[model samples]
Target chain A: MVKVHFTSHLRHVAPSDPVEAAGATVADVLTDVFARHPAVRGYVLDDQDRIRLHIAVFVDGTHVRKDILAAPVTPASEVYVLQALSGG
Target chain B: MAERLYVSTRKGLLVYARDAKTWKHHATHFLGAPVSIVLPSADNQTVFCALNLGHFGAKLHRSTDGGVTWTELEPPKYPKVETSDAAEKEKAPAVAQLWSMAWAGPDKPGALWAGTTPGLFYSKDLGATWELNEGLWNMPERARWFGGGTIDPALHAICVDPRNSNRVAVAVSCGGVTVTEDGGKTWRVAGKGLRAEFMPPDQQFDPVIQDVHMLAQSPSHPQMWWVQHHNGIFVCTDDLQSWDEITTAPISHFGFPVAVHPKDGNTAWFVPAKKDEHRYPVDGNMVVNRTRDGGKTFETLRRGLPQGQCFDLVYRHGLAVDETGDHLAMGSTTGGLWTSPNGGDDWMLLTAHLAPIYAVRFA
Candidate 1:
């Protein structure tokens, strides 16, 4: 069971508790989360089904920059979805 | 059932009151040229405006008892030095144009902070006196890069942590975000996730210029912040230590402003424009996008806004929300003054004639 922490703003639509998903890849975990929380899907995925430009995902403390959300995940691993920063 | 909207334009300040559902314009030549920023104090008893006075230099004006009359606040004078090289020191810091201003204490009425083109200035005696926060001006990085150049190391936005008055965050354009944890004695650059990729090839060594135009902190979560940059929109959870890109809008890269809903952390808004050379609107058509889920997605709101050939540039300091709980989004375009009451779902033309608006605030 991997633990994914949603930021405060996302907590509105996300599960009240950290979600538990059994998956070998990041994509599988997200798929499970989306199945439970449909409203969050549009927030993270664009029309092309690509990870939205504004959404950033991280495993542990490092950023995962890839098109495929199928990055490796372990039962004890942690995931985080970050809201983007902008302006000058 | 109309609303009265006050707008500052190039010609001067104008009052547009709603009558029978139509906006009527009343112009006042309170300032010469276009106004850059308008700040209404917390009590709504004072309206302070920054006006671009051409070669005469930028001036700050104040009006008490609403906008009935105005008085120009004399620019604060720093002690002059008499030396053998008087010529060099005599030259004023190239006409410091005020970019942004904020009133700090709700309990202490007169506490105010103002950010200008040259540096940051503060006042405890309302607008009667001023003192420059030299700690920000004396930044070594400012002198090495932005100094002597057109870019001012001045603060663009100063946010006093509602939870802790001493905890302050100031957005310094071209200087990144500076935070003071122990009051204003010490400050540090909090630009980790942000990059300044727009810099010249030679200056590529510098972190991408995270020219933060606006910074909004969630009242519920002080660590969470939303920053509007020339490059893109960013969100930070660790007091700006790290950031995530939450702007996936069609024109995400080229917006000048960002406004977070005062009550809802999940609800925030921004204006979008084409990137690169096509940044400004080609015609009169423009759009205001609001992100109900913290900028993960944006829906364009264009009910009453112009659609055809319109040039509407919603500047950095333009759009803002009032304490009344109604979202008041204002913009300065080649066209005139526009306001949106129901978030950004629909907008109304408040005025038809005025100079390009540089800034707008409820107070």
Candidate 2:
């Protein structure tokens, strides 16, 4: 099981917090989450299924490279999908 | 018949309904999101609002209940390109935001065309899926169509022939205008009368390099088109094949938006603004430059609009005309909203303050 949390900006689309899912990799977990909440898919990724420029995903408190979205995950992993802040 | 106005600003959407002769602000939606484009369907039953979500990326919301509720739809995006280099892969073209949108025609129902930063995209199933027009993308001349308004050259205007769904014309901010008679299969330059003063003297009249600001066409006249370029104004009557320069005395020839009268092809309106260096209205006095005889003579319309230290400059896609051609509305960067119910004769300011306005559409 993995714990996934969406940022506050997406609260209108996703209100409940810290949903639990079963997956072996980040891709698996995201696929499961999207299956439950499909509206969040286009908001976070382009039509080519690539993550947007300003969006960032963290696994177990560590930033994962966008090119490697298939990173392995465990039941204890905490996934945070948030809008990265780059500038003031 | 009734009239509704959709005002999309930097902050949200403002809908105004006209009851009899009095216009009242109806409702507001998408409170804090950046709404760039508001496209009403041909039947005027639905409205599509393109929202630029920071972390969530670009998105589209459909309102079938007249701004009461909305449903999410697939947004426009470029396809994935296979590359080995990590840095090269990171720099691939993607849809930063939706700059403008238009329906293909009344004949081709549910066909939507969207213009973004990278290029233009077409959706057949009403935005369920989108495909980028590689005909314009794979052009060898695209490399020279650089950006002048922002960091990246953007596709800003789309003009679809009301009679023929296949014939289309699109305008890019700094890439001039291109037309295709067979839909999106092939395109050619249509900027014969346009000029780019920023370029060298010899390259001023070259191909594929004019900063076209706005593109408009009257629904009743299917053969005529009007364009607002950064340097001057142009009109095309040959199905976007060639353009003729059309600006006379008292007309600045420089503005952000160009709107045609709904029923008359020769009638059009523009909001005058100082071109470069300072982008405000002429001498801080806001005036609408209008022409009834194509572009032969221009007249200034300013009855209730602000003058003197009023730095309200209209943005591209900020002006719109209702289906009756008797109503028109515009929004300014300084958050001023105004409308003329008597065909540019008299004006009424709806609100003195709103966010920087992006688009105004009649529903």
Error of 1 at B261 (Å): 0.3
lDDT of 2 at A21: 79
* Model 2 docking grade: medium
lDDT, candidate 1, B1-363, per-residue tens: 224455666656665554555456644546445676677755555878777544334667788866777776754333333444545543435434677777765755787778776466777877877887777666665554352124455567888888777677788667777777765666777767775657766653343246776788877667778887767887887776787766486645667788877777766677777654566743446777777787788787788887877677777777776555454757665636677667778788776555677666654
Model 1: DockQ vs. true structure: 0.01
lDDT of each: 0.67, 0.83
Model 2 per-residue lDDT at B147: 82
List DockQ, one per candidate, in order: 0.01, 0.55
TM values, all candidates: 0.71, 0.91
Highest-scoring model, DockQ = 2
Q: Is the docking of candidate 1 incorrect, acceptable, medium or high quality?
A: incorrect
Model 2 per-residue lDDT at A5: 93
